[model samples]
Target: MNFILYAVPFFVVLIVLELIVDRWRGVSNYRLADAINSLSTGVLSTTTGLLTKGVGLVTYAFALKHLAVIELSAESAWVWVFAFVLYDLCYYWLHRMGHERNILWAAHSVHHQSEDYNLSTALRQTSTGFLLSWIFYLPMAVLGVPLLVFVSVAALNLLYQFWVHTRHIPKLGWFEWFFVTPSNHRAHHAQNALYMDRNYGGVFIVWDRLFGTYQEEDDNDPAIFGVTTPLASWNPLWANMQFYAQLWNDARRAESLWDKLRIWFMRTGWRPADVAAKYPMAKPDLSQFRKFEVPLDGRQQLYVALQFGVYVALGSYLMNLADSLPTAALVLGWGAVAFGLFAQGAALENRPWAFRLELLRLALNLPLVWLAPLAGLWPASAVAWVGLLSYSLFSVIGLYCCRNRITRLAS
Candidate 1:
């Protein structure tokens, strides 16, 4: 019943179509490194959810069992209607708090790190959101909303938000008043002084309007996407950990115990005076802003794209097999994904160690193909074996052919 899985092909197709439109229209909303980093964080989030999702599910189930006041039926059309609206209401608070608070923002900031506003940026999600996101929806469980209805509405809400991440869609006038559209959502994503911390709705913008947090997109002031503290690296792991690491460092440097304890729960961007003075974080001046970029030839771009495609395939396969796979198998699959993403990030950054790490990934895959079936990590199929071999062979040959180009560029 996971609609996102079923919608994955359509998402891929639409992203491709969007890219084509972007190129044709002379609007450069898709940067190779940024898009890859966005999708990599998304892939990491989805893969990590396979393991951490139990926390949310178990808590919801427990609450529903003991705390339910009235049992809601999924079979009722009215129940579906109510659940859909209620879910969004709950989501509004979660979304608002995610931006307003420090610890939650640490997890939520992954989505805002992308400098470009495009379809890929929609997929850029936080892997750690499961740690606290489920807490917001306990109300639904307490009110006796059926688990089936809750899950369905949650997926629908998420799918509804996907199209709003595009730059191609302009405001839809009256529709803009009720729902979250590309224009208003873009304002929400902006770091502009006028646009920051406004429009915190997912499927519905009414919540923001009601709560006095809504900001309409302005013609004079263009939206500048990305967080105030830029995530300069292409690495997804680093992107997720960046804010949390900053919070941890600030906490450690605090002279007062109360300051150390309160710094985390305080407003997002609030720092102790001593910590702020000692380590003044450079906030980007939006008037003189520039998107992060790396010099890479077309060959390197193609190679990174191909490798990312492979990871996407593997990630899809792992998701399909997630429930059936043993714990160790899931861990191995997740590790492979992390490694691929890490090495690719390095390659995009033009790091000298990237080439060696990529080679190591391919070499490691050979043994994985041999051992996976026995470990029940992968199926024992001749075609699967051949496919892995073919991929490894071609990747090595591709790297070899592109060696001089990579070296010359690095030099």
Candidate 2:
């Protein structure tokens, strides 16, 4: 049940294999800091997945309670095959819309913040994408394509995308016309004008080709990576909220109510006429832009990588514990979930709120510890509760140290 125990090893295997191929081929689109940041953010996404998907699943369950839909046990292989294609079609539109609309881009831009594209880039997923993304696939539920079929195919589509993030793969000849090969996907990840807002495919390039969003990777021009408004730091939390915070500020500063509401749905970089007057720009020159590389203060990179490992261990343990716990079990599980969000937010924000979240960890767990005895799970309950309490205290002290260091730096 410890998915990361196996998943981490598997990722390591793939990463090592990718390293060998890149070195042998004299191809590298990798930077150590970026790789660490991408991997750290991805592992955090997995840690927080239940929250993202949990909200949608609950809403759908309540809304569809009248109907016995979303069921699937024994699906045909061909059903899965068809589901993969169908899901990709849905994803293509969702992805394209993410670029066209400002709010959606807030969720999707997390993937594009990476300057260096490599295996690690594929791991960079947006946890908040579930906000509106699940709505796009509801049509499948409406059509009665059982939940199992949809989920399996969606997972497979994800697996297929992992291999395409590399910079080493050339166009696969005629396969370029059909599947989402590296060349095509590379264009999707590019920030170049010719490449932006194009190639929005998940598994098949056919969607992009048919949608008129297709743009070939031009060897002469070369691709410039990252977004129009770059994320200056390597923090995953900042990566997720950079656009969102910008939009919030814009809305707050807008002159009228209409401008406030419209600012969120406007085209990717479009601003209100008044706002545009203050912030003019020239065309982006790819050659003049700084090289796409990771930004890490060496030690911060190591600290984050280690924190990623701890989260993997903690999340895996919680998954197993959640499966068997009685009603009381869920209390601790939710506590763990809150703690996860707080831990990530603290590292990402490192502000006053971060300290508040850390302090609340003990209060969150006290109920779980109190109820465990009534469930008659003494030994296991005792150990986990004690461990969690100790960890919370340690985190509190750690935050205090960080706060002191910041105070000293400011003084």
Please tell me which predicted candidate would have the highest lDDT against the true structure: 1
Q: Kindly provide the TM-score of model 2 when superposed on the true structure, using C-alpha atoms.
A: 0.77
Residue 226, candidate 2: how far off, in angstroms? Answer: 1.1
Candidate 2, which ten residues in sequence have the lowest lDDT sum?
294-303
Per-model lDDT: 0.92, 0.70
Cα deviation in Å at residue 69, candidate 1? 1.7
Q: Model 2's lDDT to the true fold? A: 0.70
Per-residue lDDT over 106-207 for candidate 1, one digit per residue giving the tens place of the 0 to 100 score: 999999999999999999999999999999999999999988889899999999999999989999999999999999999999999999999989999999
- Model 1 vs. true fold: TM: 0.97
- Give candidate 2 misplaced runs (Cα > 4 Å): 1-9, 25-28, 58-74, 279-285, 291-303, 318-411
Clashing pairs in 1: none
Residue-level lDDT of model 2, residues 205-269, one tens digit each, is: 89888979888888976777788787766566677788999888777766778988998888887
Candidate 2 residue 12 Cα shift, in angstroms, is 3.0
Residue 222, candidate 1: alpha-carbon lDDT: 96
